[model samples]
Structures are given as C-alpha cells and as structure tokens.
Target: MTDGAPPRARSARLCTLARCVALAVALAGCAGTGPGTAPRPSPAPRTTSPQELCTRLVTHWAHRLLADADGGYGDYQSMGLSNGQYEILRTVLDAGRAEERINGAVSAKELIGHQIARSCTERYRGGGPTGGPWQ
Candidate 1:
C-alpha cells in the first residue's frame, strides 16, 4: 500500500460527484418554466381612463382563482365562468393593476379575491355583501 491509506477514497469521491450531477438534472427537469419555453409576453401598456383602470383591477382578482392546485384555468361550465372571464382575471393580476385601484375600503380577502375573481363573474357571480366591505 506504499505510504498512503488506500485507493477506496477515490471511489467515494467519484460516487459523490455522480450523485451531485444526477440531483442537478432532476431539479432542472422539475422546473417547468425552464429556458426555451419563451418568456411571458409583456403586459399591456398602462391605461389612462378611470373605467379601464377599474376594469383592469377587477380582471386582476379573477385570475387568482384556485380551481385546482396545479394552476389550470377552468372551463366556465363546471366552474360557472367563461374563458373570457378567466382570461381577464389572469390578465389583470399579471398586469399588477390592483395597487392603484384598491384603497382603505378593500380588505385582504376582498382585495385579493376581487383581484383574483375580477373576471370570474360567473363563478362568483352576484355582489351582495362581503361582511361590511372589507372594514
């Protein structure tokens, strides 16, 4: 064995390196938003009209709906919403237009839900009361 302990140490190092490489590949594969899928399209230019702003705010909430944990947009039939409604909500939230429209009147839930359900008029249709308008 000459002056050294042994050759087993080299094999251990090789095994560790292989494990690291395999782990890295597995993680990269799990990341669905990995490279080459195309970056998300830029949001629409800011609007100057008040109505447009309000509508945008509503659209933001609708998109945050929790149809499934996996983030699938639901068909209006079972979910009681149309594709337009789902698209609007997702668009508004993605655009980050709510910070401008919401005020002291909005609650965390209300604001968030409104932002999420902005376009889910059918699923969460009817605006009667939400426990004193977020107060």
Candidate 2:
C-alpha cells in the first residue's frame, strides 16, 4: 500500500512493474511456442506403388512374349512376380497373345490394364502383408 508515498514515485514503480510483466509475458509466449512455424520438410518424392509396378511388369512381359512368341519364355520368377502374381502374369500373357493375334500388338497392351489391377487389388486388400514386402 502506498499509504502516504509520493504519487510520482508510486506511478513510476507501477509503470516499471507493468513493463516487467509485459516482458515476462512476451518471453513466456515465445518459450511456449518454441520456434516460429518452421518450413515443413519437403515431402518424400512420389514413387510408383506396388500395383503400378505389377502393371508395369505384367505389361512388359506381355510385350516381350508378343515380340518373340517362342524364344522369350524366361521364368516369371526373374521377371519379379510372386507365385499368385505369376499365375496372373501367365494368364495376362495368354490373353495378350490372343490380342496380338487378333487386334495387333498395339491393341494387345490394353488388355494388361484391368487384369493386373484386379489381381493386385485382391492381392493387397487383405491389408499390409506379413511374409513379404511387395507380395
């Protein structure tokens, strides 16, 4: 209580306390907020998904099979298909061969789209698989 203190002295003391409180508040706010909003790190570059990779593989093999028709019968294991995927690939190649026979190689490539999608989608719908990464 200022009791009988000089008004000017009391006013100065109050002003000093207000300033100190303001400074403390400002510093506290900064500490609570930590660094000002930092630029978020750039997102990882987009890459092909497994389904897309499957499409690419099946289509590539379909083309290769279409081209040679005989001499290109390499193992599908080397071509990066799982056992289930290899079955689909074989079916796709068979379809592609028929497509090539009927509509020509250009049109044969179109057959790869849905078959691989269906197979891969079913293959992955079970959720994150256990025994393999890309399987």
Candidate 3:
C-alpha cells in the first residue's frame, strides 16, 4: 500500500499510530482502577441533611476562629461557604439569645455557627463562662 509515499513518511506514520495506541491503553488502565485513584470520589452518600453538614462546618470554623486569634470570626463567615452562606450565619446569630439558647427548628448550619460564636463570647466575657473564676 505505497501511494508514492517515502519510506521515512511511512515509518513516521507507524510511530504515530504506536504512540496513539500506547496512550489509549494507558487511559484504559486508569479507568479500571478502583476509587483509590479515581479522578473524583463519588460524593459521600448524603446520610445527613444539608443543614446538618453546613452546621457542622460552621461550628468547626467558628471554634477555629475563636481559638485562633489571628484568624477571627471573619474566618468563620467564609470558612466553608459554597455560595449561600449568609442565611446560616444570620439565622444562627439572630435566632436565639445566649449561645446555649439557640434552638427551635434551627437549621444544622445555624446551630453550628451559634455554638462557635457562643464559645468565643463565653471565653471573652471574662473568667470563662459562668464566671468560673479564670483558670
């Protein structure tokens, strides 16, 4: 099957085909690999509600903010906010009185944020919540 093509050109074509096949095989191997090396792990089957997850994240960040003075509450505000994080913060901060009283059909996100803020306030208010007389 030589249509006036030089030997060098034919060799180059063979090389290109070989390279393409090798690449295809490599990609196929990657596809068979288990989750260990998958491009993306299937998102954890959401056993809990979004509110729950958001709340947990907010609480965690808030605690971190209070503990890490260099970070501060501002950090909590943006910690894990994907897009709509304001609602969580507003609800948590304004819904209840004291950090402990944050309740009543509260979203998980709200509870988490409230807890964090409460912790910080409690620590700052003086001798450690309830005036336990500093340690």
For each of the candidates, the C-alpha root-mean-square deviation to the true structure, in angstroms, is: 18.9, 12.1, 15.3
Question: Evaluated with lDDT, which candidate comes out highest?
Answer: 2
How well is each residue in 1-135 modelled by candidate 3, as lDDT tens digits? 686889999999999999999999999877857677646578778485444555555565544443443544553335555333333443444433234344443453355565545544443355323333221
lDDT of 1 at 71: 47
User: What C-alpha lDDT values do all the predictions have?
Assistant: 0.48, 0.71, 0.51
Candidate 1: segments with Cα more than 4 A from true spot: 1-68, 92-111, 114-135
Each candidate's TM vs. the true structure? 0.23, 0.56, 0.29
Q: Which 10 residues in a row give candidate 1 its minimum summed lDDT?
A: 126-135
Worst 10 residues of 2 by lDDT: 126-135
lDDT, model 3, position 34: 62
Q: Count the backbone clashes (under 3 Å) in each candidate.
A: 13, 0, 2
lDDT of 2 by residue, 17-74 (tens): 9999999988976664455766558789998876767667766666676677483676
Weakest 10 consecutive residues of candidate 3 by summed lDDT = 126-135
Flag the better candidate by TM-score, 2 or 3: 2
Total clashes in model 1, counting residue pairs 3 or more apart in sequence or in different chains: 13
Q: Give the TM-score of candidate 1.
A: 0.23
- Pairs that clash in candidate 2: none
Error of 1 at 23 (Å): 86
